[model samples]
Target: LLVALGSGGPGAPSPSGGAGAGGKLRGSRTEQSDDQRRKVNSRERRRMHHLNQALDGLREVMPYSQGPAVRKLSKIATLLLARNYILTLSSSLQEMRRLLSDVRERHKKRGSYSLVFFGSELHGEM
Candidate 1:
């Protein structure tokens, strides 16, 4: 989305040099330009609203404090935290897969395995 910022209001000069045209044509073009400017501004405002909403949704799912006393995360902070979280999860998942592979290899060699959990033992054989 390319948006042209800065002032281009009624007092601004028309693109064509002012010498040739009559008053009616100038007035019409000015009205058209103003209308176009308004439409562009409206679209820009809507785009920003949607962007902020998406950022808010991201903040909601983040593992940060959500209490009223805590200030909402700034846009940069929200994005950085999300990136860090994804990297952490990716690393943890890789570690878990490696551990599981080791356990499976041990079970294959023994032809049976016992998995203990919370003071309980689960014994199984292939």
Candidate 2:
């Protein structure tokens, strides 16, 4: 049975080792290993499909819209762009919050006439 499994039938020549049953088993295992490799490749393709789906979703919500003609971004580029975009947005929000706080502080000080203005004033007439 083992010899038949390796060579596919009786009186078939084994590819490896001698004409013994052990050599037949090795040849059969080689075929099995090839099948396992194919399975692994298929799994990798599925994983890449999921990864592409996630990337497409990300591209939809990102600040810069991807053009139809644009090629797909690499994984590293996508991740880096996302990181930098988020950081820049966070910094902008923080700056706006700080400015708002300063405005509120100025408004509070205005009631007491403690705010000072040093810039040149715009004049309608000399």
Candidate 3:
């Protein structure tokens, strides 16, 4: 495999010389061992495959619609939707808890509103 390291035109040296517009040595390709290049390519492919897999997993669990007929959300959209979903769930839970607490407080107040004081003495469970 040809692996060059420099600025060149179309991975090739100019007819005049290897120097570029600035008269600097544009570039030259150094032949790399086939085995080494193959290994590097394989590693890059595998890394990208793994990244795609992770994104797919995230898409599967996201709140947005996911089906063969439906288009999957982009990376940014998926993240945003997930965040919104979590926030919505959190708000709903908080509202439910507040309502429950209010009910309990009302119940407590109902029973404790009738307090009797007898000669510098307080008689009330609340």
Candidate 4:
């Protein structure tokens, strides 16, 4: 009639506790580890809650919210998407700069700018 859920302590019915049905319930209530376990579990849950809140905050600033019902992005997806967004912005800036340079060169002088390939001479103007 004894029960031990945690601490792996063997539950042995005590003859002095009166041979009654309530003896089994009292054995589990007497373990101090149960309170400690509850405290540990509460801390873990709070930590996880904070982690999820951080993820949700990250999702709020992402650029991919085009769908009618956008779902929360996974951690990997968020990271990948952010990486791609930065790459796209960098490439766009590079292309715009290249175009601006081309325009300025064309306005200043005709056929003044030349593109040279690596390990080879300029066969013709780019």
Which candidate leads in TM-score? Answer: 1
How much lDDT does each candidate structure score?
0.77, 0.69, 0.67, 0.66
Per-residue lDDT value at 89 in model 3 = 95
Can you tell me which runs of candidate 2 are displaced by over 4 Å?
A: 1-26, 68-71, 109-126
Ranking by lDDT: 1, 2, 3, 4
Residue 108 lDDT in model 1? Answer: 77
| Residue lDDT tens for model 1, 70-112 | 7999889989999999999999999978986788789978899
Please, what is the TM-score per model?
A: 0.68, 0.55, 0.48, 0.44
What would the per-residue lDDT of candidate 3 be over residues 81-109, giving only the tens digit for each residue?
88898899999999978975675577587
Clash statistics: count for each candidate = 0, 0, 0, 0
Best candidate, lDDT-wise?
1
Candidate no. 3 TM-score? 0.48
Q: Rank the models by TM-score, top first.
A: 1, 2, 3, 4
lDDT of 2 by residue, 54-85 (tens): 98788777766477776677777778888999
Q: Candidate 4 residues 1-126, lDDT tens each? A: 124422223443444442344335655544556788889999999999998887777677778843578876887788788788889999999997898677657745664444443456443343
Query: Which candidate do you rate higher for TM-score, 2 or 4?
Result: 2
Q: How much is 88 displaced in model 4, in angstroms? A: 1.2
- Cα error of candidate 4 at position 67, Å: 3.9
Candidate 1 vs candidate 3: the TM-score winner is: 1
User: Which RMSD does model 4 reach against the true structure?
Assistant: 10.7
Q: In model 2, which residue pairs have backbone atoms overlapping below 3 Å?
A: none
Which pairs, if any, clash in model 1? none
Runs of candidate 1 exceeding 4 Å displacement:
1-26, 114-126
